[model samples]
Target: MSLPYFHHTPETASNFAQNLRENSVEYVRFELPDLAGLSRGKTVPMNHVESYTLNGLNLYGGAVTLDSASIPIQGTGYNEDINFADCLMVPDPDTVSNVPWLANTARVICDTKWYDGRPQPAAPRTVLKNILSLAAQMGYGVKMGHEYEFYVVDAATRKPLYTGQPIFVTSLLHQHPALDKLMRVLNLSGVDMITANGEYGPSQWELNFAAMDGIAAADRAFVFKNTVKEFLHTEGLLATFMTKPYKGLAGSCSHFHISLYELASGRNVFLDAADKDGMSPIMKQFTAGILEHAAAAQAIWNPTPNCYRRIRPHTFAPSNVSWGVEDRSASVRIKASKDKRQHLEVRVPSALSNPYLTAAATIAAGLLGMQHESVLAPERSGLKEADDSFKKLPTEMHESLAALEADTDFIHMLGSEFVHVFQTVKTAEILRLREDIPAAETNEYFDLY
Candidate 1:
């Protein structure tokens, strides 16, 4: 009843639980986001919700450190030798939403914490919470909108459900009944959709989300990924949020739109009437921060052996750490709008990246820039092909890991334990892939990225 930062007041929680009971909710899924952007949690009877909510559900620490494939990577402290320790997965009452796809079930996202009530430092949600706390200390409240692009394809052949569809075109969606069903379930789950469209790739579809604040946004993103996969698999279809599911396909990028508000005045700090594109001096500094830390953050933003395939020149995903007004090519893109509705659209994170970790990394860079009054360099508008003229980011997963390792201060800021867990797990995967690369044709990426 008295949890800090995870948000539910006792009055509201009791009311919600009462409603769940009256609604005859049979099962409650207590979900947690893992390192590889996958949900790892257990479901309990609704009768146990009160008990778990009060005492906290005991779950393994490796649940947070496991690789995309659920393989216990060699140095994460979650493997056989140094078995995972028990951590508390305390459900946040505020995150409870009906599981529309499941029978009589309701899902709630949780916050991982130590037995002593301190946040589980390495958990993705915990990392985001820490970054949000830091932003609060800086007197900024973040409002973020996340965009996801995914592919729906035939289960056997792995060919697209629809091919050669133009971007933003919805006509092709009619060919995929599974996708049409997914839209209904998403609405039933109370996840708001801003737009849905067929993207540049064959069978690739993009979904944009309405802006939400802090952990709410993270929760929505986590749910969105799982929900899509669940619905597709149930419909006997394969859906992938992988950055690039195929070699020749144009990659799917997950873009995060960020806007900061002054806590006291309730003003959007990124908005300035005097500045062009409404990017204020503060916003400029934040952009500079993201540009400065782009290389290091790529480990968290892209974070896969296959992610490199999408970060090349001419790909919509960023290849350089540059910002531009109305330029889709730059990593930090300022939209073509001058109104107060302006926000920064970060174009680096891959569709497969852990949303919480990605958001934490992004906020960390921006806050660092604000703290130091970092200055933005000249905008690289319309010169995306001039890759040599821009600051390039790491192209390989190992190089990204090295960049992350070299960024000691940021690693410390995001928590050394988290970085260690991430690095060890990724290192093991990199090694494994080098010896025997996984089939690039499989669509089982949710658990086998």
Candidate 2:
């Protein structure tokens, strides 16, 4: 297959636009992620792509600093007073790709800017890029892969796509024509889907991606989720990455498998030869740093109030800050692997997490560990569900926010400006939900507790 048109520089962006014009592509969408990991952006005609690519289009800064419901926090300057102005959206040509399900259209993820060409720190994508920038400066590379367990249901009836006892990794259960179509669309849109299978609940699916660099991996995840939602809708089905969709069924998780490498040597720094379960000193320090800040980082890993509902026992959604060799129930799991494959699996983050912030928080914490040469606690073996003695990670949004508030040093690691806005917005969401509890209360949820 021929290479896609280039977009890494201004000249390349202009050339890419010309290529799109030659192909008669109609509209191009400039996609950006909000704090909720939801796509929000503007669509422009082919004639306007070049101008927007260079000068950028203005958008609501609140698009990056708001609650999951898109409500603006009072202090983020994204409110009615400022009219959510003063931000520019610049498309990354390197991220441009064709939209398989949408007719005559292509899309590119964008970065936010202030009028002065400064990075928009409150932007989740910006937050992540800032961390990646530091890693690049330090001659280190961060790599990650995401595994999202999600559910598909009928659009009209709002239940599982298939009815019957769900089985894990059963080929028969994954034979739906729509799933084949979904996979094709994802691959066509530049998503390298590693593997996919049926999970333990009705209509539930787990899909994995090959490990990629920090920022690019997040972009890949954004496209993966976007394609799944669009393809499911096109197939007359509704799919949700909501952490917990039902009362008794196992909740889905968006787990991240992560590792780091030495940029110069191109070696997987997370592991070493003859290392026990890949538990090198650097790896242990990274795990220690993540564990130390796990409570505070929960503000991003499990951002929404609905997130905590999924942390039930025996579900593989860990509720504690623990590590173990090949233990799926530990919050940070050191997977058993060959020397090159040594890495960690972060189990707490869910499918609905904002990819940018999730990447930002995880990398920031790990870097802090390396900076301080933090020590990993003794590794626990076996599963936590089988034993209830493990120290629990914060299980509630308020608790996580409180931990964030108390850890001023950790908050400073990602910039105080961004952390302050994030905390305020999330806390406001909790208060608003509490106020709505009486009217919104149902069988599954009551009082936003």
Candidate 3:
């Protein structure tokens, strides 16, 4: 297949407009990443693409400053109210694709920034960029793939009726006619979907995408979520990425498989055939770093309260900070590959986590390990049976926040100002969750997701 055209400058946007107009494109979807690491955007007429390309589009400043509930925290002192901050959404031309579900509809992922040219601190894309810079300085390039799981429900009835059983089943319970339509839309939108299968939860489905660099991978994730929601809503179905949508069912997770490559020779640096475990010394250090900082990084990987429910033990969910080969029970599982292409799959992250932040934190933590020459012990074969001797991830949101607060090393890596702002906003979310409902009801409601 031909590579999708990517536009990096205003001139490219102008030229792309000609092609879009020639193809009878009616609408251009402006996709932006929000603070919660979700995709939110507007669709404009194709004719207006040039104007937005030249001057950039205006978005509410609250997009980056608000919490998951869209509430503005006054303590952060970023924005006074739910006021729209003037920011520029620059279309990433390379990310443009046509939407097949809607005739003449096209989509483009964008980068958000302040009008003065500074990046929004809470921007997931920018966060990934910062981590990538750190990785580059360490003489390695990070490549990652995302395995996203979610559920689709009837929008009108809000009933989970798609995949019938509470776990992966042979037959789909109520296959909506819109499923095919959504798939077509994603295909046309240039999302490289490897497979879509029933997940271990009611109405839950998982989608896998080809791995790419940090920024590109995160961009694809944002686009994929946006396309799913937009296309499903048009078909009267609601698509949710909420971490644990249903109780008693397997919670949806967004698993990431990360690997590092040599910058100069473009060689996969993680592979070592002579080593009994097939991981190089550098690879061990990287894994050590991730394990060491896994607790502190929970705020970025498992950001929400509901996310905690997915980290329990003996359910294929990772509760301990351990690494093993092909062991699904561990937080970090080393996957077997032919060569340097081998990498570690981090299994503990929830679907609700911000892709940019999660990817950034993983890269930063791994780089830290490399800097310290940390060594990961021999890979354990059976992580499920491993006792509590292994460090476990925080089981509650508040605990995770406290862990983040205590880990000065990881906090320093994320930068003081950004970490402070993130902590304040997240603390407010936990409090809101407490006030919104009783603990039991909250757990039940989230479990039914």
Candidate 4:
């Protein structure tokens, strides 16, 4: 069957259907984004394409309205008593693609909204839209790329089957057979993967993709995560994107490399080689803004309780708020590129974070810097030495919540409704973890550490 093209209008949709029929598409997958940036979807036979494509599908808004555990909060009016709202999942024609693993199956990502046509304020995609709209007013566009690290383990035994020590050891560089298979699948899916290597943790691996514009990058990240998990499952293995599935080794991180571009000319606005640090004035201000607000942004990036455990010192993780030149310890690292592609990498976020929230927080922080003309202090160096100058990141989930609550300005920027819903949901998660002190929980995190 021929590949399906994205359609944006009614005419385009009609043409797309005709093309799919001509190419003998057997089924379609409608993928909807949940609050955590995970895609949940259902498959329908090709015969229903016309009805599903034009009218869209109905989903229980409760699917996304709840926390990770599927519990709905009464205060949010999303509980069972509120009769749980219904929302529409409208396919983004541009995101249509054929799944390489599933024969004759095409998939399209979707945006959700209320049945009455109001946007779901708690939707991760909508929150991103708010940040992008703000970026538009500054005559700049945001571009980002994510470096995702995960652990591929034996599905049945739930153990590391690969030939390597459980921690950082130089002798563990030999390629694993499963990793080779994963790379082949990634290649078939047309992902521009830049690098793949062993991480400091046991059974952990990292994959970096080429950067793209905001929306496209987010789409790629969403597709990449789902594709990796599905492919691994077929091989009787599990791919975990959890921040700290194993406690002692390095936690999985989803580091974002971000840059700003001029909307009209497509020029890299963060570049200025003439400066001593090779950073433009605007770039300095942006980095400073992010560092200043890094504590508040933790609630969005390191939302889960497990996430706070990964921010400790000496783990190659960012334990405090600081900026540096090519220093990985700093929350924000300024790298000097010989070309105009220079960008900054925010290293504090974990793999389990919602992509939309991460991007929005970064954009909002940078914009705050621009608005206030924030000036960055001298760039720090060295990873081993502790710097007391910058505020330390929250050591626990509850502390992170306190930091988030104190930053009213950033919360307001994210929309009061989103902040409230997110806080409520996350707080509930913390309570759940606190209640269940699973024996596996302590062993899983500390055994390898």
Q: How many backbone clashes does every candidate have?
A: 0, 2, 11, 2
Model 4 CA lDDT for position 254 = 89
lDDT for predicted candidate 3 compared with the true structure: 0.78
lDDT, candidate 4, at 3: 12
Deviation of model 4 at 300, angstroms:
1.0
Residue 359 of model 4, lDDT score: 89
Candidate 1, residue 120: Cα displacement in angstroms equals: 1.3
Comparing 1 with 4 on TM-score, the higher-scoring candidate is: 1
lDDT score for residue 97 of model 2: 81
Candidate 4 yields a Cα-based lDDT of: 0.78
Q: What is the lDDT of residue 421 in candidate 3?
A: 72
Cα displacement (angstroms), candidate 1, residue 107, comes to: 0.4
What Cα-based lDDT does every candidate model obtain? 0.82, 0.81, 0.78, 0.78
Query: Could you estimate the TM-score for every candidate?
Result: 0.93, 0.93, 0.90, 0.91
Per-residue lDDT of 1-449 in model 2, one digit per residue for the tens? 01111124678668868888886788999989888888899999888888877777788766777677777778765666577675778887668788988888999888887776667677777778778878777788888988888899989999787755466646655667888888888888888877878887788888777778868899998888888887889899988999887878878888888888888987988886677565778888888898889999988899888899987667788888788887887888887685788889889898889877888888889989989999886765567556677667788889999999998768877888788788888888898888774433564575455
Give RMSD to native, each candidate.
Answer: 4.3, 3.9, 4.4, 4.4
Model 2, residue 445: C-alpha shift (Å): 14
